[model samples]
Structure formats: structure tokens, C-alpha cells
Target: MAKLTKKQKEAHAKIDKSKSYDLAAASSLVKEITNVKFDASVDIAIRLGVDPRKANQMVRGVVTLPHGTGKDVKVLALVTPDKEAEAKEAGADYVGLDEYLQKIKNGWTDVDVIITLPSVMGKLGPLGRILGPRGLMPNPKTGTVTMDVAKAVQEVKAGKIDFKVDKTGIVHAAIGKVSFDAEKIAENAKEILQTVIKLKPTTAKGTYLRSIHISSTMSPAVIVDVKTV
Candidate 1:
């Protein structure tokens, strides 16, 4: 195999892209981190048919990352009367009732993710329906339903983003950036693929995965050879 060039070595070192500084020496670091220049998270988003730019919904679900997501995520909970403390103890950022629904209605649309309990579903289900059409509903079949309050909070805080196959039979989500270490993003990608595989609907026919394309948060999409993933 050919030896990696000095430029390549320097590029690999830029994988630790902390926002503190955009080191001039690391100009090619993002490209070097991997043989690609796309956002792994955004790439994952595209494969699932999610047009991040125009996505009007927030399809919620969960997946246990065998290799773990490389980034941190904020977690929020929507609980009823008795579940507030449980949600807090579980490390939820904010726990409340239906009142907070307005936040979603208003312009506080930074809900990167959410998870809810089953008992509260009946009450919140319809509310979630509003977000569902916008791809913001938290459905269990997509890994959104859970009775475990702590699990929901922890996964979100730990960067466990949720994505569900849309009506078109595809799921999209952000895993990480291509500027991220290939190994890191690749690991997360594997975890996501495995989860999607498990979510395969027994009722469906033909190819389980129509296709998968990887890209950056602001870049063109690239098809990955994930025949094994």
C-alpha cells in the first residue's frame, strides 16, 4: 500500500475538530479525517430520504448504538402528573405537561430530539400527531415509544438521534460529520444500520433497503457501499 502523504497525516490529526479554533494548519484536516468531505450525520440524513433543508417533520425513534454516537445531545421529556420526578431523576433537561406544547407551536423549534412514555401517549399522542405530519411525532415503531423515562433522557443526552422511515419507506438521521474520524462515524453508521435492520417491517416485501446515500450537512450526497452494513 502507498504511504500516506504528509498532508494526509496532518488531515487525519484534524479529526479532533473542537470549535475552539479553526487552526490554519488544519485547513485540509476535514478532508483528511476521511477520504470524503461530507457530514456523516447529514449523509445519514440523505440516505433516509430526509431533505434536511426542507424537512417539515421530526420523526422520533431510538436505537442503541453498539459503537455509540460520537457527539453529545440534549434530552427533553414530556411527562404527566406523577412522572415529573422520574423524568428529572432520569437526567431529563426539562419535564412538563401539555402546557409546554406551545413551545413547539411557537418558535422554540430547537427540539433536536424528544422521547415520551406510554401511559402519557393517549394524552400526548394527538399532540404528537401535529408534529408527526411535520415529522416531529415520537412513534415507538420508530423507537420513540418507551415506558422507561431514564432511557429516553439518557439516549438523547448521549447523542442518540432518532429517525424513522417516512411514508416512502425510508429513514433519515444525522450521525456525525465526515470531518469526524472515519472510524467514529463508521462505527455510528454500523450501529444505525443494525438498528434499521432490526426495524425491518415483516409486512413489507421486496428489498428492505431501497438505497443509502451519505453526505454533509451542506454538501452533495454520495452513495456508500454498505452492502454488508
Candidate 2:
């Protein structure tokens, strides 16, 4: 095994691996351990007791973090010429139709979120192999495919994020940056936790939320008490 650096060892020393912390305490501890120079992202990992393979047990939803994600979210709006101005005015980083579609075809998925109208979805069908894998494909359920291009772009810019349980039954997401106040980090974590609780699949048996953990981009994971969440 690789040796831990002095900073890494110090960070680990401050954490009690045997004890689970409340949301607030976990959030604060994560900030105390983050020693990266750049603003490291504060991430939350939730393990659910549902079988992701089962159709009825699928958990997916969107949540707008109360304090907003500290990172700048880049949004791409693929719409007709008529809606180009609307998307641009709403803070979309890239806007257009054919040219952008061709760019995507050539494996140019440099944007974070992709928003397009229902009419334009047909044109994107062939490019699913490129977009689907990158999580850039616009979907109606996630509000990424809609006629309201402006509203979608604005929401994404304001910290709206969509998440789904992975095959391993773990839902991972970045809540905010370590630079944010401990209270802000806790609030963001709570917002996502509450939202996840609300999305519990009816068919899921046993404990819905099995475990929860919070950590910074380069810090040790802090286990969060399921009861306090």
C-alpha cells in the first residue's frame, strides 16, 4: 500500500472511523479536513436498499441545492434558430442546432447539461450512443427536453441537478464546495437527503436509506448517521 502523507495522516487522525456523525457534524468535519488549494467539491454518497435492476425500484430525480453548487455549471442549449436568443439570454454557454448536433456527432460533448426541445429530440436519436453515455442526452423526465429552453438553462445555471441510483445502489453527487460555510454545506446535504427520502421507491423493501457519507474532493469520507439525516 502507498504511504499516507503528513497532511493525509493528520486529516485521518481527526476523524473517528468507528463513530457515525450527524449531518451537521459530518459537514463541519469534512471542511476541517479539506487541505486542497483549489475549492474542492463537497460530495455526498447515499447507499439505498433498493434493487436498481428492478423497474419499480428505480430512483431518479432532480433537486436545486438551496445554497447552489459552488462550481460554474456549463449549459448547452440545442434548439431551432427562433429559440437561440432565448437560450443565450438565459445564460446558456452554447446555443445552436445543426452545427452543435454535428459537433456532438464528432464526439464533442464538452458541456455539462444539454437542453433541447421535443421537436429537436428526433434529430438527436441517432447520437444517443454519444450523449447517453456522457449523461448529456436531454430527457423529458429530467426537464432537459422541453419547449421552455430558457427556463431549463436558467435552472441548470442556478444549481439544478439530476441524479439516479447507480447499478451498485449508491447515489453519489456533489453538493457544494469545501470553501462554502459549514452551515451551507450541511444545508445542501440535507436538501439532497430529504429529496432522496421523498423519492423512495414504493416497491423497495427493508431500509430505504441504508447508509450515508459526506466528504470533500480530497478528504476522508465521514459517515453520516442515518437517524440524524
Candidate 3:
């Protein structure tokens, strides 16, 4: 195993492995432990009790963070000419159809989110291989594929994000940057937790939220008490 750096060791020292902290305490502690010079992204990982291998147990949904993700999201709007103005007015970084599609086909996915009209989905089917793996593929369930291009683009720009439970039954999402206040981080974390709770599958028998942890990039994970959250 690689030896921990001085900062890494100090961060780990602050966390008590045997104890689970309340949401608010964990949020505050995460900020204190992060020693990176740059504004590192704060992330939360929730381990659920569902078996993701079973179709009925799959969990996936979207939530708009109370405090917008500190990162300025870049959005690419692929729409017909008529809807181009609407998309642009809604704050889409890149707006167009054929040209953007051609660029994507040429392996250029430089944007954070992609919003497109329902009619344009068919054309995007062929590029699924490229976007799917990158988690950039627009899906109707997440409100990315729709006729109201402006609404979709605006929502994404305003901190909307989608998350899905992985095969290992863990849902990981970036909540905010370390630069945000602890209260802001707690609020964002609560928003995601509540949304996931509401999406609990009926087939999920045992404990719904198995474990929750919050941390910043390169910082030790802070265990959060699910009971308190």
C-alpha cells in the first residue's frame, strides 16, 4: 500500500472510523478536513440495500440542488433551427443541430450537459456509444430529451442533476465545491438524500439507506449517520 502524505494522514486523523456523524456535523467536518489548494468538489456516496442487478430494484432520478453546483456547467443544445433562438436565450453554451451532431460524431464531447428536442433523439441513437459511457447521453427520464428545449437547458444551468444507483448499489454524486459554506453543503446533501428516499423501490426489502459518506476530493470520507439524516 502507498504511504499517506502528511495532509492525507492529518485528514484521516480527524475522522473517527468507529463513529457515524450527523448530517450537519459530517458536512462541517468535511470542509475542515479538505486541505487541497484548489476548490475541490464535495461528493456524497450513498450505499443502498437494493440489489441493482434486479430490474425492479433499480433507482434513478434527478434533483435540483438548493445551492447550485459551484462549477459552471457547460450545456450543448442540439435543436432544430426554429428552436435555436429559444435554446440560446435559455443560456445554452452551444446551440445548433446538424453541426453539433457532426462534431459529436467526430468524437468532440466538450460540454457538461446536452439538451435536445425529442425529434432529435433518433439522430442521436447512433452516437450512443460515444455519449453513453461518458454519462452525457440525454434521457427523457432525466428531462434532457424534450420538446421544451429552453426549460431543459435552463434547469440544467440552474443546478439540476441526475443520479443512478450503480451495479454495486452505490449512488455517488458531486454536491458542491469545498469553497461553499457547510450549511450549503448540508442542504445540497439533504436534497439528494430526500430525492433518493422518495425513489426507493417497493421491492427493496431491508434497510433502504445502508450507509452514507461525505467527502471532498482527496479528503478522507466522513461517515454520516443515516438515522440522523
Candidate 4:
């Protein structure tokens, strides 16, 4: 095993492995333990008791963080000429139909989020192999496929994010940056937790939220008490 650095050792010593902290305490501890040169992203990982393989137990939804995510989200609006101006006005980083589509066909998906109209989804069907795995495929359920391309682009830029449970039954997401105040981090975490709770599949049995952890890039994970959240 690799030896821990002085900073890593100090961070590890501050966390009690045997204890689970409340949401607020965990949120504060996350910032304290973060030791990185760059402004690291504050991430939350929640393990849920659900069989993701079962269609009925699939958990996926969208939530807008109370305070915007500290990172500047890159948005790609794949729309026709009629909606090009509106998409650009709404701050989409890339707005075009054919050129962007051609780029995507050539294995280029450089944007974070993709928003397109329902009418345009048919054209994207053939590119599913490239986009689906990256979670960049626009879906109506996630509000990424809609006639209001501008609204979707604006929402994404404003911190609206969609999350889905992975095959391991863990939903991981970045809540904010370490530079954000502890309260802001807590708020963003709470918002996502509440949204996840609301989306609990009726087919799921046992404890829905099995465990929760908060951490930053390269920081030790802080355990959070699910009940207190």
C-alpha cells in the first residue's frame, strides 16, 4: 500500500470512522478535510436499496441546486435554424444542428449537457451508441428533449442536473465546490436528498437510503447519518 502524505494523514485523523455525522456536521467536515491546490468539487454519494436492473425500481430525476454548482456547465443545444438564435441567447456554448450532429457522428461530444427539441430526437437515434454511455443523450423525462430549447439550456447553466442510479445502486453527484460556504454545500446536498427521497421507487424494499457520504476531489469521505438528513 502507498504511504499516506502528511496532509492525508491529518485529514484521516480528523474523521472518526466509527461515527456517522449529521448532515450539517458532515457538510462542515467535508470542507475542513479538503486539501487540494485547485478548487475541488464537493461530491455526494448515496447508496440506495433498490434493484436498478428492475425497470420498476429505476431511480432517476432532475433537481436544481439552491446555489448554482460552482463549475461553469458547458451546454450544447442541438436545434434547427429557427431556434438557433434563442439557444445562443440562452447562453448555450454550442448552438447548431448539422455541424454539431456531424461533429458528434465523428465521435466528438465535448459538451457537458445536450438539449434538443423532440422533433430533432429522431435524428439523434442513430448516435445513441456514442451519446447514451456518456449520459449526454437528451430524454424527455429529464426535460432535455423539449420544444423550449432556451429554457432547457438556461436551466442547465443555472445548475439543473439530472441523476440516475448506477448498476451498483449508488447515485453519485457533485453538489458544489470546496470554495462554497458550508451552508451552501449543505443546502445543495439537502435539495438533492429531498428530491431523491421523493423519487423513491414504490417497488424498493428495506432502507431506501442505505448510506450517504460527502467528499471533495482527493479528500477523505465523510459519513453522514441518513436519518438526520
Error of 1 at 144 (Å): 3.9
Worst 10 residues of 2 by lDDT: 66-75
Evaluate candidate 3 by giving its C-alpha RMSD to the native, one decimal: 0.7
lDDT by residue (tens digit), candidate 3, 8-91: 999999998999999889989999999999999999999999999999999999999999889899999999999999999999
Candidate 1 ranges beyond 4 A from true positions: 1-42, 45-61, 66-72, 105-108, 201-206
- Which lDDT tens digits does candidate 2 get at residues 122-163? 999999999888888899999999999989998988889999
Model 4 Cα shift for residue 58 (angstroms): 0.3
Model 4 pairs in collision: none
**Candidate 1, residue 77: lDDT:** 76
Pick by lDDT: 2 or 3, better one: 3
Report lDDT (CA) for all predictions.
0.56, 0.94, 0.95, 0.95
- Estimate the TM-score for candidate 2: 0.99
Q: Could you give candidate 1's per-residue lDDT for residues 1-229 as a string of tens digits?
A: 9676775565445544333211221222323444444334434632343332333432334666544555555455777768788888877766786766667655344554566777767765546546666655666764556887776776666666666556654577666655555566656666777776765554444565556655454333444544545
TM-score (C-alpha, index-matched) for candidate 3: 0.98
Task: Mark the regions of model 2 whose C-alpha exceeds 4 Å error after superposition.
Answer: none
